[model samples]
Target chain A: MSAAELHNNEMIHGYLNDLRRYLSRLAPHETQEVIREIESHLFDVLDQQAANGQAADVAEILRGFGDARQLAALYVAHIEEGAPPPRGFRAIQSVKKSVTASLYFAMAVFGFSMAFGLLFIAGAKFLLPESVGVWSTPHGDSIVVGFVSVPPMATPEVMGWWIVPVATLLAVGVAWLTRKVLLVLKQHM
Target chain B: MNSTEALMEKWEVQLRKGTLELAILAALQQRTLYGLELLKLLQSLPSTTITEGTLYPLLDRLKRDELVDAQWVQEGETRPRKYYQLTPLGNKKLTDLTRLWRQSVSDIEWLLANPGPQPLPNTGV
Candidate 1:
């Protein structure tokens, strides 16, 4: 009703808004429950202050709750990490684990095979220079690359010695990317 | 604060953190209090004092752990307050923690009471 009371209400609302934003990670109902409890506590404290003939110092009360972000973080940490998983959550957790595991192995297999394929081509170019070559068709309609026992009849070989360095670079790049991906996946697992 | 006072404050914080759960459980024994009421009761004590920031989240955790139960109660025109009480599990926890606390206090008191003029007494060792 008073100007001061209006300002205090604004401050409380502002604090609660910030708290709600920080607590967005919680389920909607859980977030509302936390907000409601704190709101109730804040108003109760104000009433107590009024009953005692003391002016409502919203700042002092908010200080007891500390920063809204910090308070929300405490709630989030306990709810997310401290509480045990609910029933049927174990199945979901296992499924998640398996998915990560499959992704990791699949990535390793795909990436390493590609890398090894490139490396093999690069190496074979030295041993069988005639067989392993990048070739352009007579009509230049398509290009073929990789190890071939008979180099493709009448297709002029291109990239000569350049294929070795190019393939080697590609192999290194693929291997590095795979390692980075696996590292990220390992953390989730 | 000066270094000595800061050190003392740090020690007090550690002490409070260790005893906080037990203190909460003990406070709720045979009582149902809302957040503000519980906070006031805790602040009334010198050592068990805690802020709203600490209490609410800890209470949430206790409820999640099934150690405490909370209910929203409306009285007349006042806002509905979430009242908390110790569950059976919470009471059992309180009993266990109280025994541990008393034992710790007695052990420390024994050490403090006995000054080293003679060898420390050994019983059944």
Candidate 2:
């Protein structure tokens, strides 16, 4: 429509506001610019409609552009393309994110393994008597074997008490080393 | 029409969105202008359009490519505004695009004039 004949300024303002609110929540810094672009696009469409004698109210005509979800997606794409991180920063960020995820996954595995070990100790204590005794290896090293609070003793099937502290320390040591290895891997990758 | 068809049409319109960037660049080639001025010129076009926000990013891309140059100018009682002008590279590209565009127009016109049977022969020329 000709500038002289335009009459829907207030309606256009509101329409732009609605679109702006939807876009702003998706991308804060660039929302105003996005609103301006959508306004210009809507204006062009309204201008064409006016020329065609189909719509007298450009603002009213634009009130129908829906799909808040799609609009949000568009804002995301716009920000992605327009404000991408530097390649170096992106590489570092991705590595950090992956390593952090792997750490959590490994922690879960450690927790489950510890739980199983405790269960085995509990089951052995419940089924077997505390009458076993400590034994000596060929190296003249003495080893103690028993469940929690039971006297040091040996059984052919049950793991030794020494094994408990050793395995716990070893598991902890491996996890700590793995964390360092992950840090090094991230640094190199 | 079904809602799916309406969505498809919207997607179709979005795919045609590249023309807006092309049109904006073409308009900026005519004169050095700030964001609002360039948007105004594009809105004045018969078959092209652009938004205020869209121009900034497109201009940023063009600037990054060294296709356009921008400078901030301060006026007495207003905040400085950035104005953009086509760079030498941009001018060179615009010339190339103009040639290709005009050639396409003429090619389409020739096709319209000489209605062919079945499709134009496989002129591998």
Give the alpha carbon lDDT tens digit for every residue of A1-189 in model 2.
556444566566766676666655443545665565455556655566668987566644453344434554555453466666534346668887887777766765765565555445444543654533234444545555435355533424344455455555655666566566656655553
Tell me the tens digit of each residue's lDDT in model 2 across B23-83.
6568777588876667677767645554444555567667766788877676796445567
lDDT score of residue A127 within candidate 2? 61
Model 1's CAPRI class is medium
How good is model 2 by TM-score?
0.43
Write one digit per residue (lDDT tens) for candidate 1, span A1-189.
999999999999999999999988777788899999999999998998999999999999999999999999898895466566444346778998999999999999999999999999999999999998899998989999999888788888989999999999999999999999999989999
Q: Per-prediction DockQ scores?
A: 0.62, 0.08
Over 4 Å off, model 1: A79-189, B123-125
Best by lDDT: 1
Question: Clashing residue pairs, candidate 2?
Answer: A37-B51, A132-A153, A133-A153
Task: Estimate candidate 2's alpha-carbon lDDT, on a 0 to 1 scale.
Answer: 0.60
Model 1 residue A38 CA deviation in Å = 0.6
